[model samples]
Target: MIVCVAIVGHQNNPLYIQSFTEGDDALKLHHVVHCSLDVVDERVNNPKKSGPMLNETYLGLLYPTENYKVYGYLTNTKVKFILVTTDLDIKDADVRNFFRKFHAAYVDAVSNPFHVPGKKITSKTFAERISTIVKAFGLSSAG
Candidate 1:
């Protein structure tokens, strides 16, 4: 059975989750923070020897120490999905100011109750909202 995992997040930050079954070193190490699931981690970290670059990137940030949440879940069939919400805190006044225009659109519009779990998020409203937010924050060039 093919397990599908969908990760949706705010415009400024995007999540990268790699499947261990695919044997690409560059793709595995690229933008991956950490693997919560044991099997995934073992395949990427142990056998592949991808090093601690992901953890280093995550821990090396200069942001204040706080419990910034990373969103993720495992399906009943054991497929995992993860979302990295923000690279840094949105609580900072300057950061919040930068994202103010997109705040409502993110917290309310895209993540609304109508969007069901485990489903591919293809809402035009959501996409448009993200595009507006990205442009407003000058994050169009951001990866």
Candidate 2:
């Protein structure tokens, strides 16, 4: 299951962060997300010389803790999307799909005329869409 989803800005500032797990794990998850940013930066700066992934946005699984796995996606505009999931055996395609849908939702949210760039996302519609997306995670690609 997905425990957290975060959107970090180009400057490494957090644009949005939401936790799906219960209890006080939110702080730990936030720390995990923050730490993953360094990895993202390193990957973006020092990409592989040869491979299809050289220009791909999906960074795949950044790192996996004993209890959770972190995945990252970087947009052409430099926005970063983070996903923390408890499922250890998840497929790469599933993670990619999740990021794709999540990214689309994010784009729609920020497209609002009232949305100030770099500001925290506070739209109820965005929250609802995110909630729906989170709940639907991994369900579509099950085969």
Candidate 3:
């Protein structure tokens, strides 16, 4: 199951971060997400280390810890989306699907006239959509 989701800016500043699991591990999850940023940097900086096309937004599995697997997606605008899940064997298609939906939600959230770029996302509607998406994760087959 997804334990955490994060949106970070190009400067490594967090825009949004949420943890679904109920426990004291929110800090741990946050640390894990933070550490994954370096991996994302490495992958983006050294394209030869990654197998996929350089232009692809999906960076695939960033790394796996004893209990969580982290995935990353990079936008053309240099925004980064991070996903942390306990399901270590999750399918690539599922992760891709999550990013696609999440990115759309992010775009919609930022499109608001009052939203300032680089500011934290505070839209309640966006939060609700993210909650819905997280709850529906892995329930349907990805195309």
Best by TM-score: 2
* Per-prediction TM-score: 0.32, 0.95, 0.94
Better of 2 and 3 by TM-score: 2
Which residue pairs clash in candidate 1?
none
Instruction: State the lDDT at 140 in candidate 1.
Output: 29
lDDT of 3 at 44: 86
Per-residue CA lDDT of model 3 for 33-137, tens digit only, reads 999999999988888854458779999999999999999999999999999998856778888999999999999999999999999999999999999999889
Q: lDDT tens string, model 1, 1-143?
A: 01111233322122322222233543432233343243333433454335654332121112221333233333223333443233453333333343344344444543667865445455677556655544444342232
Q: What is the C-alpha RMSD of each candidate to the true structure, in Å?
A: 13.2, 1.4, 2.2
Worst lDDT 10-window in candidate 1: 56-65
Off by over 4 Å in 3: 49-52, 141-143
Off by over 4 Å in 1: 1-92, 98-103, 110-114, 118-120, 139-143
Cα deviation of 99 in candidate 3 (Å)? 0.3
Candidate 2, 71: how far from true, in Å? 0.1
Query: For residue 124, what is the lDDT in candidate 3?
Result: 97
Top model by lDDT, which number? 3
- Steric clash pairs (candidate 2): none
